[model samples]
Target: MSTIKLLVTGSTPVTVTTQKVLVARLGDEQSSHLLTFVAGGRSIIVKQTAVRTGTVVVVVSGSPGLIDAELRKAVAKAMVIRSTGR
Candidate 1:
């Protein structure tokens, strides 16, 4: 997929290794977000609307080390944004 948009909790960690994807929390294994890694090719023009509360997306892009720290910070900020109505 050239683009992938997934609706996952702010708690999900961004994992980028040999594969690029997101990891869902325990017991929520069926989340397709966990399997999305293709940023090169597949589908196009996909759009999503949360339609839910306390749902925010924090995207961190860069090297693995950078992404780890950035994602943590971003997610924290996103949580605040969600809680305060953003």
Candidate 2:
């Protein structure tokens, strides 16, 4: 299990800790991945898409946060374990 500490900035900045996270590639899209986690009694979903131009775009929905860039980084740092015997 991987733990991520998120620093959410808003009117009052606060830090949120999340341990349960899932990272997976969507279908056969090599440049896209899905990240899901629970925080503040709500589900957070982050879709990361990487382009061939060396640019990455992240779209976050659910449980809105002020620090979107940081949230994206935390989601990207999550450990994804895949079973080869599937």
Candidate 3:
């Protein structure tokens, strides 16, 4: 299993940052939202239960090599953009 933390920065609230990432990446988010997504041909679980003032932590858990470079970069970019409001 692997864990990745997405840090939220800039003026945008952490709440908004989380929402943006969910909407952008996790399109099929249910009310429970603990959905499994396929990345690098592997099923990955995305969880964002922790919402802090300056950080939006999105933990991706699954087998080894959880997420690829592209997806990680995309999520990080989303968080950064949401934070900076740019």
Candidate with more favorable, higher TM-score: 1 or 3:
1
lDDT of 1 at 49: 15
10 residues in a row with least lDDT, candidate 1: 44-53
Q: Which candidate model has the greater TM-score, 1 or 2?
A: 1
Error of 3 at 66 (Å): 13
Question: What is the C-alpha local distance difference test score of each model?
Answer: 0.38, 0.40, 0.38
List clashing residue pairs in candidate 1: 1-41
| Candidate 1 lDDT over residue span 8-85, tens digit each | 457444332233344333121211121233333442221111112234544444444444445445566667777788
Assess every candidate by TM-score: 0.37, 0.30, 0.24
Residue 51 lDDT in model 3? 24
Clashes of each: 1, 0, 0
lDDT of 2: 0.40
Tens digit of per-residue lDDT, candidate 2, span 1-86: 33455546554333333333343342322243345555565765545443221233334443324333344454344322122222
Q: Residues 1-86, candidate 3: write the lDDT tens digits.
A: 22333334554322211121232333223111233444334554443322222445444433223333334554566577877997
**Model 3 deviation from native, Cα RMSD in Å:** 16.8
